[model samples]
Target: MPVHRVRFASVRSQRDPSAPAPSVDAREAAEERLLEALAEAAGADEPVTALAAILEDADPAELPLTGAGRTRAQWEILATLGARSLAAARVLEPHLDALSILAQADVPAPSGLLGVYASESGGVTLTATRLTKHDDGSDTWRLDGTKPWCSLAADCTSAVVTARRQDDGRPQAFLVDLRHPGVDVGEPAWPALGLRAVTTGPVAFDAVPAVEVGGPEWYLQRPGFAWGGIGVAACWFGGAVHAARTLRAQLHRRQARADEGRGTGPDQIGQAAYGRVDRLLRAAAVVLGAAADAVDAGELDHACGMVEADRVRGTVAQVCTEVLQTVGEATGPGPLTQDAGHAQMVADLQVYLRQHHGDRDDARLGAALLEDEHTGAEAWW
Candidate 1:
């Protein structure tokens, strides 16, 4: 079959002839031009570069939100899915998430630098990284020690990290430049079977200059924290959708083969699998949409917001797991072994879904629900 190419940029150009073309890097410009030519190609390639160019051309402040200007949380679900379809969500989602966090926290980020959030502090155990405020009369802050699970550690130009305050032992968020002196991006430690492109590893800060982003404990206490948690679920949902697409394609191929006397027709087992996955995905979408609406309505301003976010994330994670099992069983090992994209999508979805905290999160939700019930608060229907 001959591939038809459709350049997305050309469509925009045709719509607005007088729109000014923003200046971009020569290499990026060349890549965009090439992609424009390949838009109608049977297999569109270089989705990461294409998406990056589109994002760069727009002002970060004006990105659309999901659900009637509901917080960016809802919009993230669609964005993540689009990136996942191109097999680039692992590389792009974190950078976008960082930008969203900074905007929510009201942190001023310089234009064009990719931002990362690396605030995993090992729960109760203090992270090796520590932020110290010197007695010397200056606004200077210094970061020292090692931070683990720093995604995009080497690639990000800047990061928002959590460290224990030397003065009062409170955890605080600090913005630091990766290019500054005394910052070392460690060798990659994320050699897991999936998300190889994410590049998560340790980062050592040796008196690296930084500025505190918010007040002590503000990062977690802020409404945006819950909003961000739900956003991760959106990415998981997107990846799941991509995995489900493989199963749908395989089913179609089997049906076609049967019609041509090459294989059997769709059977009861395939029908059941399709039905279950369809229902699960639909339910998940509803939950995500409701959560997005709640966020936009400022429902996440209190404990209820956390409850809703946790429920949505847990429910979505369960749905993704079910979809993975259904797809694997119905399609067998053919797609896993024969299709590279399908294999990558399956592996990536499995790893990314682990972002959910499993029993811990469920327990938290259970306790909150019980508390609400005890207080005679309105039942969370």
Candidate 2:
């Protein structure tokens, strides 16, 4: 799908041709389409096939490009998908992020699903070596070693991967074809509680052919790097939204029963818990919205991307933590034990939230402030 065209989910009335599309409408529409496709493809023999079907149905242009004026629409869709299915959102968000990344680099996305894998770990790294180009002016390279945390490696046909260049020792982004003969997707570390449907594990590449995207250090230096991180926070926030909704549902059940004179209404404690959840969730949403607007306005055009992303990600992570804690306390062990969906959501959110570096990220932010004499706390204030 062209990034230029958009097709909303139509949760409300169809968009008026003269009017701009709203973020909430796009979110609901995409969620409806995704939920239906997931329901229809639920019984597929393989998870990858099911995932492919759902993704193939979701138009790449469903939400406008981030910073294309409808940036909030992009995040709203991400949050709703996270609310519906983090496993599914886990796969889809990167696919969408890849589209924006490719657009930023003036590269046309290849047909089929794409993944954005940038993570690396100790003792396991993917290295890129330039290969002799064909007479057709192709810029190809070979990749070797293992790239960790490659979610849906088997499902994606292609990916925008970041690998350390052997010549320069600097990381560069590449538009890689996962179908290359030298590529090998390893077995997932299964039985994991969160994002179980998404096959996230190590991928071993042996001389895998690839096409370089932007030059060395281009991927991390790009503004999309921070925008992409904020997208993940959008998923985290959405997961919290669902968790709060689950608690709200339990409260409603209690209140309904009490209205019939059969049980007591929501007590002060439960009501207080809901209030706290609501406050945190809305605050996070506001931060996300402001961040979206800033991106669209090109406010982070310089090098503030890292600082901007850390603040939003850290705030959202803290809120998610508090919401999970309060909900668990208010609802007790019933949802954890009795409700499978709620249980899975809570577990998935917990594991996904770990992507946020917690204190390490906080320290990074504080250090940024302290190291730069020009950067005072009042700048943030």
Candidate 3:
């Protein structure tokens, strides 16, 4: 039977016709040009270098930010779509997200410090890194410990890291110069199956000089923290979109061969797979859009922001996983084994989605919801 003869057509065409179409002319001409440039540069041999060059050429002040003119949700859509275009390009998304959060949080950054947020505390629970304030009558801080999962560790000129203060033992945000003496960017600890181009590893800060970005616990307490978390989901969604494209291309090729009477069309199973991926993508998009809208409306400035961000993160993570599985099963090993880009995208996305803290995050959201109910503030409809 023809692929279109399956229920996939009806399922895909179920969009509400009465709903207004999303605006395509949202970005300014310059922004559009920058996006095009980034897309082209994303395919470069060194994507990080290309990203840095693009950032240097573009006016940092004019760069897109959440809640800046355009709807925050729309910005997320654009961001995810951009990331989806190139798997390697996903590396730049986190830095951009950090920049956006810093701006939103009103955190002061040192001049000429290219920001990469390296606040991953994955291994810190077992072994905490301390950044003590050096009370030498001078405004200097010393970092001593190893930070794991430092993405773009080597490429970033500076990074915002969370280190416990010696004064009070509270985790605080600090800006550290990657080039500073005693700061060691360790060997590639990310021996994962994907995201090889975006080098991440353990960074050892041996009494490295650092400047505080915000007060103790300010990094996690800030609204931008939650916003930044949701932005990660945007990147995941982008990666999933790319994976979906591989499946789509495979289906198209099969259909073309069928049209030429040279091969069989997509089977009912293939159509079902496509439908599943479509539903996952659409659901993830809706969650992201809602989160973006919340951010734009300043709903993320309170406890609600954390809940909403958790929702987006969890939803996007699930969608990406489903996309990976569905696309893999639907297209078989052809794309994974033959298409380098598809394979890399799959690998990159798999590793990236692992950033989600799984049940811990879900538990946090659940507890928050329970607290909301106790306070009669449960507005999660």
Candidate 4:
């Protein structure tokens, strides 16, 4: 599929490698260009070309892993992608997460985009059976059954699949090449308004050839799980940032209209809403940034890992939810109806942020705190 490539103006903002340090200003300037390019690309009738440009430039493979003392940079790269295009972020993030998963076991994934299809929803169950133990002490395996919520399953060249052992019924992670004859990419059943460019659905495996990535249950048990979750929260934060940016843009134009010629503008009546959106988004940013730092510090490696993930995801999701509502109300229907960029962003965020389980996750956090006896005054902090 053809995609709209970013214009030279956008790539020019990327700082020269040998010129100087990639200071905060340089990063922000480059990110600003990316955001603009994505906004321009979102309305294209092509494939994910703008996002592909980002991948080419960012080199997601070389990105630092979580808890690698540079986790902030990793999350920031994802956040920047999310800010302009969640559909792009939706497809790109899994590849990055899958790479991190492979890196955990020092297993090399097949070249090209990858997917992480572990969710076993819709009453489907994938089972893995050991096929043969090679003389090199490597065991070949096969996967059977269906995995659901597989975003870009058809597009990915390979995937890190999670399947239960046929004999012991224990979960295990396996690398499956999607091109296998036994692998079936289901019909595109994605019926959603957001992230539509990434057609997510179920995939069936019938004795698909595979290789294990790590030991049984290693996928979720790894520290990268929580780190990955936090990374998604950072995406949520970035999505909200876009919504806030939209709100700000709308208010400024109308305010200028009121100040000069056309007195019919809201006269900055929506400024308060913009203020709320700004404050909430900034707070969400701080929360995610701090969470990235915590992951790198190894503070959330094992102890209360899920709790921190839930907290950060929940906080960012809430901020995004409010931004959606606030921006919609503040801008009224003008932007939604007239501006394709603003409308597409709102719709995309609505679907993307739904990945968070909302109150269910909050209940889990409460239950975890109670069960762990983690009650204290400073704990409130």
Q: Which candidate number maximizes lDDT?
A: 2
> Candidate 3: what lDDT?
0.69
Task: Give the alpha-carbon lDDT of every model.
Answer: 0.66, 0.80, 0.69, 0.75
What digit string (tens of lDDT, one per residue) describes model 2 on residues 216-333? 8988888888899998998888788878988999999999999999899899999999999988887888788778878887886535767778898999999999999999999999
Cα lDDT of model 4 by residue, 1-381, tens digit: 232221111211366778977456665455455555555565466546555444446544455566766677667766766776777667667877888888887797567777888887789999999989999778899998999888888778788999999989999999999999999999987777777788888898998999999888788888788788887777766677777778778777876887898866654558688778878876776777777766766677554678788888998898889989988888788888898767877888888788899999999888877767552211445
Give candidate 1's error at residue 210 in angstroms.
1.5
1-381 per-residue lDDT for model 1 (tens digits): 221111111111144558886668664445344333323221346444554454455456554332235344334434344324423545445555566667666677654435455555544222323344468532467777788777766656677777777767788777888888788888987777687666677788887878777777887777667777777777777767767777777788889999999999779899888888888877887787667767776666657767887888999999999998998999899989998877877787788887888999998888888898553323457
Q: Is candidate 2 or candidate 4 better by lDDT?
A: 2
How many residue pairs clash in each candidate at the backbone level? 6, 1, 0, 0
Kindly give the stretch of ten consecutive residues in candidate 1 with the minimal lDDT sum: 3-12
Best by TM-score: 2
Identify the superior model by lDDT, candidate 1 or candidate 3. Answer: 3
Candidate 3, residues 1-381, lDDT tens digits: the string is 111100111221356789987565634556556666766667778777887677656555666666554445334534444444434445555556556656655665433326554555565621224444457532567788888777777777777777777767787777778888787888886567677777777788876877666666788887777777776677777787778778888889999999999999899999999999998888877777666666766666657778887887998888889888988988988988899888878877787788898899999888888899553335467
Candidate 1 stretches with Cα past 4 Å from truth are 1-58, 65-87, 121-139, 373-379
**Structural similarity to truth (TM-score) of each candidate:** 0.78, 0.87, 0.83, 0.85
Candidate 1's TM-score: 0.78
Stretches of candidate 4 above 4 Å error? 1-44, 49-61, 135-137, 264-268, 373-381
Better of 2 and 4 by TM-score: 2
* Backbone clashes (count) for model 3: 0
TM-score ranking, best first? 2, 4, 3, 1
